[model samples]
Target: MATLPPGPVRLYGPQFEKDPGALYAEIRRQHGPVAPVLLEGEVPAWFVCGYREVHQVTTDSQLFARDTRRWNAWSQVPQDWPLAAYVVHNPSVMFTEGTEHRRRAGAISDALDAVDQFELSTQCERIADQLIDEFAGTGEADLMAQYAERIPLRAAVAMCGMPTADMPGMVRDLGLSIDSSGQESLDAYGRVQQAMARLVADKRVAPGPDVPSRLLQHPSGLTDDEIVLDLLVVMAAAHQPTTYWIGNTIRLMLTDVRFATTLSGGRASVGQALNEVLWQDTPTQNFIGRFATRDTRLGGQRIRTGDLLVLGLAAANNDPHVRKDAGGAVGNRAQMSFGHGEHGCPYPAPELAEVIARTSIEVLLDRLPDLMLAVPAESLTWRPSIWMRGLTSLPVRFTAV
Candidate 1:
């Protein structure tokens, strides 16, 4: 740790719960774009916060790579580190580099591309209606638990050819994998990997239109093991962020002055609100990140070979350098919410996430024209995790039809 900068700002704790944007601004002011910081276990890392610095790191895959095997601090890390599971190296597309990355990422991209957006939207509508029906008659509901949380995960499972019965288990395990670390994360990952292996086995016998089946039959000729791991990456990437996208966008339309006024006629502004959320309260805040392949200077800090650099994604989106000319992200699409360059959320994935999020809000607005937040916005709280941004619950009320 002595090799890194001194007096590193600890990135964990309650200060982030109130206003993480404020903390990011402070970090940038004191330490510049790339600041010294500590993770869950006082683990030292460089937090990449500047708009251009993030772009520089993510785009230069050769210099800042995803493979955790190159991390030099492994010897100093404790066996019980809470964040250990977040950086575990696996053979999946997430850790693969070079030609192997191209093949695995290509197969995932091709499989996801084959999903007809129109069909995906139609399925989302049905899922939204079904979920709404469950709570509509009650006259009041926690939208986070009742509506926002359900729609995206179901679509993810269905399109991946996973059985409807498996949805409950996948949801439980996936939540643990992101929110918890240590053995809990390891256990949750194991369960999902097993479920994916089963899905791959089924698809091996009978190919279908879902992601798993498509990955199985992809011309790239993926092995069963490869299909299982990559499917894990695909499902994990799609499930959490997309779920929070739907939730956070709904929160914006309900609380913010700009979009709340259009509650009854909401479709026109849904796209704008979605973009605004990406620039403001991005769902995945900190990506546990890249390792330096060789010593380099970034944001005026000396980055050593094998040093860990966490991407402060939400901070990058809020960088004054970028926002000064953005004129507010109402319709601007330049935010790094989906990341950038080769390791960015692959093509069509972000587009498809928009399809799901947009249709979901449109359907809810159409169903409950008089929707209202049940409590003051100040009383609402965010889930406490440095990695992901989401609400504990969004309580709302409306007249039953």
Candidate 2:
């Protein structure tokens, strides 16, 4: 008879659920790298915090399964809902394991490699110029509402070959999905379901030269639904977090003078600045969850079967044990900002670096060139979710340049 693995850990509660990073940091400080917690009754899980261990565990697919069957068994929602069943269920390159996952991920990886940073740089400059033109003289604008969010959202949508007519509603729906209200979130999920279904159907007839089309033509023979859901997953994953990162990056740079000067120098300088931003304030702060298909030992702890292994990638990035320059300025890109292993984010980091640097500089270099915070640093509202770390709103004042 096989030995059963450990039970699920109750890591998520209303308080920790609301603001997990703060609590997660505390837990790491008290315990070493790994700690056990009970979640949802008696389900025991080990929250992996050590950078090296998290990296190792995530890389070891055989030990810790990335199979959806294991995940669905541990998920919060029932399997019946399309949002639960299809959106998260549809096998994408991101969530699978072993040979199959590698095959699907290869397509995306190849596409990302082929992405031209020069072309992307041109687009970034064009979009930045246009957006800046709109708010050129206007001293006041919601950066998040107007530019930061829309740029990446538009890019991701275009990358998928989705119609522009559908973008506004799609962005709205996906945005609401991340908001606090439960009813609103469900409603947003429904809209996502409807939008993806329609888009997939249209693409099936007339596929374009985009990620979705590539997935459709993939050797894995992904169904229309799978292609659409996977694309949606990509869209949903990239949009808000990238936007938030851009905002946070800009805000942080504006505050730190020496850092700001280094960033303003040129392209290579900008790349280093981007790396610093990713390490300092990683947008996706949450421990993207995984389920243990079988018994496994991680970080000196026994992980039992059916247990939820929460890998706190954010905490690991900030771990004193790993970060070389704990007190100094952002030094090197030694963080898991894009995650690790087979499921690592495949977007061209250089393209993103260009986009963020160009857009942010365009805005602040002129009108808000010396933009200073209107609110106290501590008073700024931090997003409470464990999944992300950013200001909900950051008010700043600057003389019209």
Candidate 3:
């Protein structure tokens, strides 16, 4: 109904990747709550950044639907568009609504609820210790690759009833499956599917006290295809966000003098440090895509039916309207890092993610008290992805113990 802004900001490219927060601030100043942006491959969508607006969009699933089948872009844009990798239609709860969403989400929640939080924490600590031991003798290691990535993957796979021997190949394939380009990613996805299929078969023959077994016994009676997709969701959800959460919080402690002083001096707990990171550098920067069910207006912007809209969780968390003092964000658990409303992440609930991150980081820090960045904070590079914000590497030197 209104003329779209001229030359809408392109979400991809080096400048945006390097410093997205600056761009988000500019967008807020110029476009208010919502702005038109081009995702990878020039895919256009609405990016909702205002705190209130994001809350509304996420909670009011009736008006703003999660089913991408309602997406107009799917018909207009080529199927191979880079953003398609993220927005592509899937059979999981993430792409469903109404009763279907409840049914699928219920199964996932039940499975996750069966997880022993104490055991999970113990498992994470064990994995963290083993990973730390791998590089403990070296005195220097890339924490991102060595610690942050391994802990979550090991824990997630174990929870899924996957074999420890399959972890290396599965992790490798999962990494490739998330890659943004090339035929290797497609091949990797195939491998992941095959591996997961095997896992499902194994669980069916001899069920265990794991997520897959729980999902199998759920009332929904999810099919094998549905089971595999849901398992992939759990694995990916557990690995990516948890990895970033652990790494970002640790980075904050290592780089920010105030946090380091407070943490080392026992003035602040690991939970406080993690809450600050959740508010500031949220793991998944932008998530929960919803397609407009009909022509609508939000934050003074017009939206046509089937238009794709993404929640800018990171930007909304930083919105001055909701978060005024960035320095005082410690213990601010109100941030939308874990998301809001119905389509939010079910596994590793907000408190659980925080505990896992805190325990993992504490174990590493305790084992390597002298751990510090090997390079300046500014020198570190972030992984380039429109959906996630994560460090590519965190090279740190620590005293061998």
Q: Estimate each model's TM-score.
A: 0.94, 0.81, 0.94
- Backbone clash total for model 1 is 0
Q: Would you list the rank order by lDDT, best first?
A: 1, 3, 2
Q: Which candidate tops lDDT?
A: 1
Taking the tens digit of each residue's C-alpha lDDT, what string does model 1 give over 105-124? 88888999999999999999
Best by TM-score: 1
Q: Write down the RMSD of candidate 2 (Cα, Å).
A: 5.7
State how far residue 328 of model 1 sits from its true place (Å). Answer: 4.9
Q: Which stretches of candidate 3 lie over 4 Å from their true place?
A: 1-7, 262-268, 325-329
lDDT of 3 by residue, 1-401 (tens): 12235667777788678788888888888788998888877878999999899999989999999888888877567666766666678787668889988888889888888788889889888888888888899899999988887777777787787888998899888877865358898898889999998898888889999988888888898887899988887777877898999999889899988777765443255777788888888889997498999999998899999998988999999999887776665455778888888888874455566657877988887788777899999999998877788999999987777
What lDDT tens digits, residue by residue, belong to model 2 across residues 266-364? Answer: 333444556677776777775546667777777777777766566777778877777666645356655787777776676564355446455555544
Clashing pairs in 3: none
Poorly placed runs, candidate 1 (over 4 Å): 1-6, 164-189, 326-328
Find the 10 residues in a row with the least total lDDT in model 2. Answer: 1-10
